[model samples]
Target: MVSLICTLQDHRDDVNWCVFSAKLLATCSADKTVRVYYTKDFSELPFSPLSGHGYPVHCCSFSPCGQYLASCSTDATTVVWQMDSGEIEAVLEHPGRSPVRVCAFSPDSVHLVSGASDGTLALWDFTSRSILRTGGVADTTMVACSFSPCGQLFVSGSMYGDLRVWNLELKQLYAEKSAHDLGVTCCQFAPQMQKGTGGNVVQFRMASCGQDSLLKVWNISYTPHAGCKMQLLHTLTGQTAPVLSCSFSADGQMLVSGSVDKTVTVYEASQGTLLYTLSQHERYVTACAFSPMAPLIATGSMDKSVNVWRVEDGCSTHEGKFLPGEEAASSCEGGKMGGHSRLMPSDWSEDDVSSWLRQEGLEALVDVFKANNIDGSELLALNKDALATDMKVESMGLRSKIIRKIEELKMESMCTGVPDEYLCPITRELMKDPVIAAGECWWSTSGFHDCAYEEGT
Candidate 1:
């Protein structure tokens, strides 16, 4: 993981989902292609691009047995493909819907379950290529759904603040809980559960996040006569904004959460204790996962970057760290106290820049080249070479105009590199929220213990 063993850049846009099967890693992109990459980098083309989706691909998963592949698209269908041939073995279509948002293969590989934006859950018979049952929850876009590790149950959390625990075998609702006050963005079942110190037979636990700006954990216990008793055991507050994604570590000791607040927090499972916050992302952290084989945590963000961090290494802080010759470091002598000037942009102010806007002047020429969408780097080189000739007011005016034009161009370029669907819903320079950094140990927001009840009433 340290070396970035390989790079797969086939997708013309964002790669939203990536799933692994023993030796194969498959990625689904907004470019409407599912690419399969071998773990052992092939000297030849390492990725086989599987394309056919009529719309952007949203999610992809490999079967538990690692023999089959599944993907969901904005095209209103879920596809199951044969890994070796890039052939579609089954297509599960949902009518009266915008698109399927999530799809997963059960542990036994007998069933494929998909949840869509229309608030419908479709159970598919994987072997027969037929829809088993289609059920409706409140009509809200479903963001994420997962099959319980045991394959005995399935859970769907909606953007409408409803979390449904469904008995897959029984094909009925076991428990419906309002876990979030607003849309439930992400939810995950605990990897393991056991009877507690008080003899409370906890079968499983789940964590959910949403618009309420809090993470809620439920204690799920099965009773002989009452079906399942779901209790809200703990409400953890740290994220300052809605949590967009959450995942439980394989060992069940740690839980990881990514939020629109632009940070990732890892928590202790049993006691609902906050463990660490990983917040290196400069933009909204979209998805997070704990490695099934190691203590590594991976996070994807709107910063157009993916980061991997150590589980033991807590949240990344942007606070200043000592480094040599960095200008902003403490070691710098006499650079001016309270140095705000250093932070100003090079072209902070301009006056009489009209002369620089002409077609014949170097700055004017660059402006013309830019407006014509000519070679940008070539124009940049011409401007740099011309800058060495004079320090006249006319030259300065031209420079200012060129600078302004460049700024305008950059602003327009934002979010243009990726398809509109792949752009994260929350992305405006995401940073670690103050609350998430404090974890469960303290309410850093209010500067006290048990702060939510004190101030939030």
Candidate 2:
């Protein structure tokens, strides 16, 4: 895999989260400082440090437009910062009862949702700088909160393993689900115009991981059923230890999960099949993420290092394969060497469009609807026809073939162009200008890491 971008260390202790914003990388640490580094020059000095958290920060994130930074700490406080000036714009001290676990900005950047230990969820308005509403408790400490993609509804998960859906406009609980036997780790709304599943249905899903060792997926459709609060559609449970964190890829087609077991697993979100297992870290994998704009994966660990892995055509069985940087272009081929089965035939299904979409679109566009919701039937009908002879299917088949050939070419270049001495242990990531530790071990680096250094040494 190609490691196009690398992480640089500026924190002395564990790094909680690193956000890329407007050409600067801002990271929070257990050392209670926020350091901003330049992405282009990893060796350059960092901007001034911003410190105010009384305890280790749990998470830090940037706004959608990259204008502001928000962070939550174990010290019962959440701070908002001006990214350009590195100045604290607002400090929200929660009521004496709870320490904030997580905080997120709305899509418009006018509101913020926070989850705390007191079993309460709070919504604040940026303009008014006041709490607009406090979502009542179900006696479970809320660990994570997220707004639906449409911003019409919001949901929160708790330490008691409960999940609640709220009508944000009405400020009332609309639905609830007992998602896990333990606490829910995170929740996210699918982005708009996202293809794969739940297309334009105003639907959302929640991933709950606790002591259960499984990641449960729920289907929260807008159409509320009297008895169906939330649909438990799929459960991904191969982790040997508790799944501490889970995140969806930009397209929502893939899910990356980290666990106390020291392994990060990548799965097909729609199919729930384990696609890849990142086996580089020697300690508990605490953080993992997909680059929003690229196919690369970045993971951090208690091992005090960060490693970057890219999504290439190479199969899991071919983890250590690599081509020298100098040989990449001269022997260039598409990247699909033995990656997956040849793409299915275009006419394999016969229909190009999904039945659900056709039905939903016709119904939505047509004024006269049905009595029993014929829109669903219309969607099914459309899907059946589209699947029958969609040209895209044929294109997909061709793409698959091309991808496989590319992989073969990459492998060929690596085998022929690269010298034996230049080959590092193929770590499923490219190390541009790699510097192995004294012992000849490669590591994830932004700063000095003893364990990784020892391995290299």
lDDT by candidate, in order shown: 0.59, 0.55
Residue runs of model 2 more than 4 Å from their true location after superposition: 1-8, 18-26, 37-45, 169-177, 193-201, 224-229, 313-457
- Winning model by TM-score: 2
Instruction: Write the residue-wise lDDT of candidate 1 on 1-457 in tens digits.
Output: 1212233445576556665443455667677977775533422223367876889888887775455688999999898887657788778787575698888776556678888898888888776778888885756887777776545567888877887777654345554546787778777777554443332123678887888888888876642224566778788887888887777766566777777788888787678888666567676766676544344555656564545555433221111121122221211112211222122222212221222232112343534444444343333223433543532225565566555444432222121222323222222111112222222333233212231123342
**What is the TM-score of each predicted model, taking all chains together?**
0.61, 0.62
lDDT score for residue 432 of model 1? 19
Tens digit of per-residue lDDT, candidate 2, span 389-423: 53233444434433442233223222122333343
Best by lDDT: 1
The C-alpha local distance difference test score for the whole of candidate 1 amounts to 0.59
